[model samples]
Target: NVYADSIEWMSRHLNHRENVILSLHPHNDRGTAVAAAELGYMAGADRIEGCLFGNGERTGNVDLVALGVNLFTQGIDPQIDFSDIDQVKRTAEYCNQLPVPERSPWAGDLVFTAFSGSHQDAIKKGFEAMDARAAAEGVSVDELEWAVPYLPIDPKDLGRSYEAVIRVNSQSGKGGVAYLLKTDHAIDLPRRLQIEFSGVVQSTTDAEGGEVTSDQIWAIFTDEYLPSQVADERWGRFELLGTRTSSDMTGDVELHARLRDGDDVEDTTGHGNGPIAAFLEIVRGRGFDISLYDYVEHTLSAGGDAQAAAYVELQIDGERLWGVGIDGDISTASLKAIVSGVNRAIRTRQLESRLAAV
Candidate 1:
């Protein structure tokens, strides 16, 4: 039930037939803004005003994208082309200098994804059927596809690009890897590779005990398949060593790693696709569930294994988090980063739990 005594008072004062643009700034501190907004919308309020990312001084305001998306989903024309939501999100992030977390409500990287094997299987079948139907009708697959098992709404409806669909790393199971391999390399890895890669990912994640991101998945893949070469322009070095070692059926391994920054040395092991993958796996084994939402690295000095700094965003129980790692070895730097990310996740979870108990 909505408590709209304040809004009711304002509604009584307004001209009954006036086309009012409802301007609402809700503080999530009480978790009642959304209900209030919904009541107002149903009460015939037009042109609702809200903050872009729910950002403000206190517990934030109503999320405009959320309100707009709701309207679009309800068959009401929101006066915006939501078909390219990815582009819209990009513009917002750039204009506001904001980072969209991996687990944000509508725009997060993992928002439309599924991790469980059963859910992935269902989504895969749904996409396949959507493709077949669209082909039979001679229409665009985009038009036929609905938000399947994992996604709430068609990503295309929000203008998301196909390129944003991600796979790899540990959190991803078979379906994600299949999508990535087909999209990027034009070569579908065998079921064995899928299982092997899943194990590589799972072991790493279980060790860290948290979520992983697409960019980090790519970094792990680079270390596994192309160790001598960097994963991407951003990655520094591709190497993994285990203070404590374990192996998978594919002969990939995880290692416990110790990294040093100046006089401060952080001991955190991580897993990878192979031994490098194992490094991250071992870290996951230590109880960190880190996922790399996005990362950026820049060379600070001359060539020949120059120093690289890594930035990563992590999600734990729906809250977004970030961490940084800097070193000469890009792989180590990334791993150390994610370790810092796990620390943040743990800290956040602890604080949240303490607050809840109070």
Candidate 2:
């Protein structure tokens, strides 16, 4: 109130002739320099002076970056260019030898990153919809209105890519992992797969006690699902040879499967209400105790020729596991998911046995 009153008094009495320009230079003695500067501007001050990153004695001076960006976000031009804020932060840190907090507004490492599941999901979907709309309208991304979740300003406007916007940690969720994979590797995972992968990421990060990088996540994905048919001798327990499904007018479905299990090849026939059920019955008849709990499928890419992705969750002996598969055919993808799930379950049991021995 005193600062505003002083500014008002000066503007009214000292600058009555309109021959003088009032300026404000506020300190951080009370840690309100930025507020003082903003108020001074509104109170008719023509100019305000502050140091970068609030680097001064005591609490230092007001943070010009914060003040300026505050104005920029309000659709007001602060007449300052902060398009490359990371560079600005680097320069400041180098010259001052003072580290900036990771949560610093607009200039920190994790400022643009989201860890919560809901936030990550909203942000991911928001960016996707924005891009689709921009492409449909034949306009640049900048021309589109900015309304991303949990982000006040577009990071790209500051020369930052979306790669770092969603990082995975123990507290992260399915959407964050999916966003990272999609942005970094162009692999768009289905929703169920995202959930499945999030569990893997959480476990890895929990064990490592830190953030999981994109490369590590990709390695896990490949190791879990992309085993070679011929090179993976351990996976010879079940190799899909061929499958045929027939549906009659009464809605009855019959499935015939030829499977090679460890040098013992055999043909099996089963009847169920659906293809997956029939396949499960065949496996059950072979002495495997597996039950399907959940299933989800989606197209990985756009257009008619896009690839499909499927995710399956199975309960095997009271333990649950998830699997993912991708292919040009939806049915094939689902079957692949089943195979992946069984393989993962087997691996889990082996790991448990080893740990118990240890």
Candidate 3:
């Protein structure tokens, strides 16, 4: 209130020439610099001046990035584009030697991200609605209403996305994420999976407001690929606890596994040419018939401590689905891969159902 009033008074008394410019520069001593600057602008101030990302002495100056994106969310095309927020953050951090907080609005790492099952479900449904609406209206999702749960504005509006940012802008997208997984972690994502997972990488990149590191990418891969205990509920509650495999003289492998989805535990036995085959046989007996479409395996490193990564493509419900597993034992990796494939398919179906309900 005082700052805006003072600006009005100053403009009236201090101007001797018509060329004099009235610019409002507010410091964030009380965390009201942005509000003060806005008020001063309404009070006939020609412009507002502040540091990028609010970097300055004491409590910091007004964040010009925040101002820009704030206007962007309100259907205003701000003069400045903070869409490539990470690039802006990098430049601001470089020039000002100050780090933007991870929780900062429009530019924070977690501000636009949706984590947990419920939040993910809501966002998924929102995206589906957005896509459908965009298609029906024959408009880009960016040009239409942006009401995706948790995410305020499309990163496209800000000029950053997986495909756009990764290759041309040096950021994460589906192809880049898949390449990183294959090269660094030995995870060769299928073509469909690349498309599906790119959405994830896109959101993560947007959430992180920076380059998604290899380690972060690996973490996302494992979390999304692994079979959760909740999966066995819809497809017979049997979470694999432990496994035992033995071969007979006839070249058939007898596999036994301790399966527990809840507090109850049971043992299952199946016979086939290998552990993976026997594992699928066990699942087949449970009414979920799955056939191996393709299988690939590789070692993560050399020598003793190396871990094996297995990629199992299974034909389920006329869809070619993929699963991945990593373990010290190749057989175990194969078995886990089979299980992961089923779990991944179930999760995909669950998302579809959620979208349908929406």
Give the TM-scores of the predictions, in the order they appear: 0.49, 0.81, 0.47
Question: Candidate 2 on 108-204: residue-level lDDT in tens?
Answer: 8888998888899999999999999999999988898898888888888777877788887888899988888888766777666688778878888
Better of 1 and 2 by TM-score: 2
lDDT of 2 at 146: 94
lDDT of 3 at 124: 50
CA shift at 265, candidate 3, in angstroms? Answer: 2.1
Off by over 4 Å in 1: 4-25, 83-100, 113-118, 186-197, 200-358
Identify the candidate with maximal TM-score. 2
Could you say which candidate leads in lDDT? 2
What is the full ranking by lDDT, best candidate first?
Answer: 2, 3, 1
RMSD of 2: 3.7
| lDDT of candidate 3 over 86-190, digit per residue (tens) | 887888778877778887766766665443334544555576688799999999877876787767777666655523212201243455566556656667666
lDDT of each: 0.59, 0.82, 0.73
Candidate 1 C-alpha RMSD relative to the actual structure: 17.1
RMSD to truth, every model? 17.1, 3.7, 14.1
